[model samples]
Target: MSVETDKIEIAFEQLVDIQNTIDTVLKVPKNPGHIGVRDMLRIIIGPQTDSDQEKLSEISSNFLARRQFKALLKSQTLASQTKQAAASSKTTSGQVRRSGDDFDLNLIPSTGDDKLFYMQLKVKNHERFAQISKAEMLFVESKGVFSSVPLPEILDGVSQIMIRQGHPVLDAFHDPEAEFFIK
Candidate 1:
């Protein structure tokens, strides 16, 4: 076989060996179920390094924050578009195209006896709001709540929370504290 073919065969064998090891460690049944890459990595590495853990935490926090930001931006854009469409339609036809009362913000039921009902309903359906609240809490705890904190500040606070949670990556090259400058 050619050198490249030989190398590919060796790599394939190694992958099979790793899979067998994982199956053995996990005590897979006669018919093994699917195993994901993260599970395989955990089995191989045994335990993550502090640096690796920190990086993972930072990535997760950034992902959540960015997702929340994007959701907010999308909601605002849609609302603006809806408003513009309604206005244009009204100007053309001299009649309201949509009813303002169609949507109700108040969560009060007809009975109006339960005070916490609205809060519970909001929390149950709005998971993204909960995540944003947690992120905001981290920022407030780190640096007291500001009248208007910038987006970067919020992201920095999320990073700090990850560091405080015992995932400090102190390696020289990948040190979290090291500052990067662009020339």
Candidate 2:
């Protein structure tokens, strides 16, 4: 692996070590399931560093402030990712890092396969997305635990399977008598 690849992996490890907040923050790979308020609370209150927790809070506040974040936060589950299919991520266009929104300089080191299983999984996901008429989620396999390129906070950068029905999990987070569905 290149020096750059090593650096990206280290950064990814830093994120994984902190907490599995990426899924919750990004609200992707929804991983079909149901968790009651009790379980949800446990995850949000689980073992995470103070700084990590703060980073999660800041992330929600910064990009997703417009949404009902408290409700969303309450809806968080301790779920791991399940396979989903979606479109591909954009690649580097040039040496430039930012060409408006998309990263033109997606300088992650190349590798033939991270592991055979993961590579097959990635290939299957890509193929599955191609078949789905309206694919909402994508199982993005980075170069490895550390991707070859630096991944940024993908808020509006990536399109998702937009669930406009007002998050199903978040419904449990709300007070039954207080909040109504949708604004």
Candidate 3:
């Protein structure tokens, strides 16, 4: 099944770009949760840093301090949102689950240059169905009419997944070779 997406979220896009950068320059630890920030300058800025801790300490503090501690403040807001999610999240059966993956629906544009992607959609009425539903081919929206694109084999010896804003994704982010992972 194919679904029309809501507007593409810019904040989410920015987050994705930031993650793409982090995953490019750092080393991925075998375990997860965090990247090894052995050299703060190298991790945050890049390898061409001055390699002087005292200077980097100032830069780091400035980055944290600018605009009234914006990074920390933004994190506080995010923390609160998750805190509230637990209470607001409820299903008819019991607790609500979050499947935060970005690719439930796959939207393809007419061509590669197209900015809009076709993907699965969430509708107003069908939010609470606890089952797996599959379709032979997916609905594609373009040219004022719907077309069809067969779903590609999702996992063909490729790293076929990433969790948005999740810790496990850190591994994928740091592996430069993972850049080619299928969306």
Candidate 4:
């Protein structure tokens, strides 16, 4: 998906640039029962363009066409993927049971560059989840020890797994060589 957005400060003689911006935005999705593209164009142009009706109409048509084209492309891609997945549906019993190991946090990489990390966790209760947010002890070599790191900092480090997968989590912000873990 490609989106081209351009903005300019309020000015005279460059009314066409504002029209072009409106023309390009007509490609936004339409659903959930809200305002139409024309109304949105009016909102963007009315206060800034001195109520120019002819320019508004031109901008509206261009933007609407672009939006429809993008929506059509997205719908086609989704339909193709759904069709492909439906055509492959075979499974083995042991293969399915062994898949549980994929979620094990202990299997995550724990070394290199101090930027890569991997961790997996299974939370059984809300209090456990809160404890994760309040992680104060370092889990290294299968033993827990009390530490002095703040709760928010610990949560931020744990959140990195969602952003980057297959990287070892490092402890440069805490102790450089200590291994950190969460349940």
Write candidate 1's Cα lDDT for 53-98 as tens digits.
Answer: 3333332345453344333333322111112212212223222122
Model 3 lDDT, residue 11, Cα:
61
Model 3 residue 157 distance off true place after TM-score fit, in angstroms = 16
- In model 1, the worst 10-residue window by lDDT is 138-147
Q: Pick the candidate with the highest lDDT.
A: 4
lDDT scores of the candidates, listed in order: 0.27, 0.28, 0.28, 0.31
Give me the overall lDDT of model 1. 0.27
TM-score of every model versus the real structure: 0.15, 0.18, 0.16, 0.19
Q: What residue pairs are clashing in model 4?
A: 26-63, 27-67, 116-167, 116-168, 117-167, 117-168, 117-169
Off by over 4 Å in 3: 1-133, 152-183
What residue runs in model 1 are displaced by over 4 Å at the alpha carbon?
Answer: 28-183
- C-alpha RMSD between model 1 and the true structure: 21.5
Per-model RMSD to reference: 21.5, 26.1, 27.9, 24.2
Tens digits of per-residue lDDT, candidate 3, 56-170, equal 3333344332223223223222111111122222345432222222222212222345343333222111232111122122221111121122333333211122123322222
**How good is model 3 by TM-score?**
0.16
In candidate 3, residue 177 scores what lDDT?
Answer: 24
